[model samples]
Target chain A: MFPTPIARARPSVRTIYMFGLPVSLFIWLIPLLAVMLTSIRSAGDIAAGNYWGWPQGIFLVENYMAVFQNSPIAAFILNSFKVTIPTVIGAVALSCLTGFALGVYRFKANLLIFFMFVAGNFVPFQILMVPVRDLTLKMGMYDTVTGLVLFHIAFQTGFCTLFMRNFIRALPKALIEAARVEGVSELRIFWFIVLPLMRPAIAALAVLIFTFIWNDYFWATVLVQGEHAMPVTAGLYSLNGQWIASWHLVSAGSIVAALPPVAMFFLLQRHFIAGLTLGAVK
Target chain B: MADSIAGKSYWHQNQRRIAPWIFLAPGVFMFAVYVIIPIFQSMEISLYDWDGIGEKTFIGIENYIELLDDEAFYTSLINNLLWLLFYMLAVPAGLFMSLFLNQTVFGIRLVKSLFFFPFVISQVVVGLVFAWFYDPTFGLLALIFKTFGFQPLAVLADERYVTYGIIFAGLWPQTAYCMILYLTGLNAVDPEQIEAGRLDGAKGWRMLWHVVLPQLRPATFIAVVVTVIGALRSFDLVSIMTDGGPYGSSRVLAYYMYEQALSEYGFRMGYGAAIAVVLFVIMMVYISGFLWSMYRQEREGR
Candidate 1:
């Protein structure tokens, strides 16, 4: 509305504006489009220096199959799921309780605790790197899936709590007050009254956390060592090292590693955007 | 039976006071152990000298002293400064992009999603994509350079261009993120004000500068905050694309810290901790600013 809608503009300007949209989008997504194209290129195509040209032969299925067969990529994808699903459940469940407390209560330390979570969420990951790794090693969970999952759950709780608390704060308070006046226990109030209203927040947080933990490369490298426990991001990096000149396989693996989160985003775009843009408006 | 009834009544009376603590206990415990306590631990670790697996020797401020004379440390610091500066460009770039795509044309929603596709993918993939894009022989840049009768540039292999190359790759997704934020903010803009500005003959850039931007403060603030954090957390791209290579010219503090403590480099845990502490201190400055702003908002809301 601010630029004066094209509908009211001169026919020439409107035509130009409409034509410009796809051109700009094409330029913007060129990198991804290249990779998507490269993933379907046959090894013969790559070897013949046909990097950016139309592929003479499509090997989409073959390249993807080779990625799974020739490497530990399947295990990596499974590992990603194994780590992501638990962290999502643990972090979201914990935040619901924390959010309910901070949002509903008027306790003396309410803001203090809330700010602690907020502040913790923003600290750079490097500061936590050394100690967290050491802690993981000492717990005998080093290079294990449980170790990665636990740390992710703990670290993600900070952001999830901040998100959940702010969401709960915006809800109507009349129902909560009415339920409290009826002598319902606080736990039941949270379980029955509040939790039912929080489905959207839960869904939003779940998808966001799933994407975040799924794409996590840093922790996967730091805490895990072997192919058995490595998630796809780190696994893909290591595989990149091995398949030095095999751009086709690397591109296919990259796409495979990125698929789950991309799928999640398309499936839950509304909740995902709702979660991300929470603070962008008043 | 009377005692049981009394117990139930007492619980009913005190539940309100006790409920918050019960709700907070698990989350607080986990956050403190994994996030809060480690911050202090890293600060303490910075004061010592240790390999990760062995005993730590206390040599106060020695790591910091060494960092002052270390050329790589300075290089990383400068590169980080460059990253912070260049990353701010995403804010305006995103605003421009959002304005360009703010129309209500057909299939606009799909167009917006396609534009936002980069942000949803992992940084590792972005790095890989850009690495190919900057490939000296077969890359798009090479093709463009060839068309113009210039030499192909191996961007990641040149020390001067490596950091900038990686930063440009980082900007792709970051700009997308900011664009999405602005698009959402644009949705909530008051149409009445835009109409009023049009009536006042404030059209195009004038309307944007005078009327639209003031309403976009929240979006701008969020965009700035996330971009700063994104710039600082630029380890993934550096790791994947260059590995702080071409004679370590592209190393930022985050990547350098990892190199010092982990990787195939000798595990100087204490030195790594020192580097992390420096990055942490820098981040804390912004963190405190953000928290202070939030505090003021809370007070006003109350």
Candidate 2:
């Protein structure tokens, strides 16, 4: 509207504007498009240096199947799910209680505790790297999916609490007060009255955390060592090292590794955007 | 029966005071252990000399002293500064992009999603894609250079261009992220103000500069915050694309810290902690600023 919408512009300008949209989008997504294209190319095409050209053969199924069958990618994908789902459930459930407390109460340390979570969420991961690794190793959960999942659930709670607290804060306070006046126990109030209203926040946080933990390369590498427990991001990196010349396979693996989160984003675009851009509008 | 009735009354009277703590206990405990305590532990580790699995020898500030003389440390610090500067460009680029796409045109939603595709993908994939894109042989850039009668550039292999090359790759997704933020912010812009600006003969860039951007402060603030954090936390791309290669030209603090403490390099856990502490201190400056702003907002909202 600020640019004086194209509908109000001259025919020539409107035509140019409409034409420009796809052109710009094409240029913007060229890297991904290239990878998507290369992922479907046959090994013959890659060997023949036919990267940008039309693929003489579409080996999409073959290349993807090879990625799963030949490498540990299937296990990695499974590992990603194993880590991500638990972290989502744990972090979301914890944050709901924390958010409800901070939002509904006027305790002395409420803001202090809320800010601690907020601040903890922003600290660089490197600061926690050595200690977290040491802690994981000491717990005998090193190089295991449980170790990775526990750390993620703990670390992600900071961000999720901040999000959930702010969301709960924006809810009307009278409903909570009325519930309290009805002599409902505190836990019951949270379970029945507040938890039902937090579904959107829960969904948003769940999807966001799923994508975050799924694509986490740092923790997967730091806390886990072997192919047995590695998630797809780190697994794909290691695989990329092995398949140096086999660009077709690497591209296919990358796509496969990236698909779940991409799918989640597309399916839950509204909640995803709501979660991510929470502070952008207000 | 008498004792049960007394317990019930006590809980009924004190539930208001106890409920918040009960709700906060689990999250706070986890956060303190995994996030809060580790920060102090890292700071403590930075003061000692250790090999991660062995006893830590207390040699106060020695790691920091060595870091001052380490050339790689200097290089990493400079590269990090460069990253912070260049990554800020995403903010304006995203604003420009959002302005370009802020319309009700046909198929615009899909177009916007396509444009935002990069941010949803992992940084590892983004790095791999850009690494190949910058490949000296049989890469798109090589073909473009050949068309222009110039030599093919091995971007990651050249010390001069390696850091910028990686930063350029990082910018793709970062710009997409900022664009999405701005697009959301644009949706909430008031139309009455725009019409008023038009009545005042402010159109095009004038309208955007004077009328639109002022309303977009929150989006810009969040964009800046995320971009700064993203730039500082740029380990994944550096690791995937170049691995601080071409004589360690692309190492930022985050990557360097990992290299010092982990990887195939000798595990000098103390030195790595020192590097982490430095990065942490730098981040805290920005973190404090962000929290201070949030504090002010909280106060005003109350």
The lDDT leader among the candidates is 2
Clashing pairs in 2: none
Which lDDT values do the candidates have, in the order given?
Answer: 0.93, 0.94
Q: What is the TM-score of each candidate against the true structure?
A: 0.99, 0.99
Candidate 2, residues A87-176: lDDT per residue as tens digits? 999999999999999988898998899999998999999999999999999999999999999999999999999999999999988988
Extract clashing residue pairs from model 1.
Answer: none
Give lDDT tens digits, candidate 2, residues B82-144.
999999999999999999998888888888888888989999999999999999998899889
* lDDT per residue as tens, model 1, B162-231: 9999999999999999999999999999999999998999988899999999999899999999999988
Instruction: List residue ranges in candidate 2 displaced over 4 A.
Output: B1-5
Scoring model 1 with DockQ, what do you get?
0.84
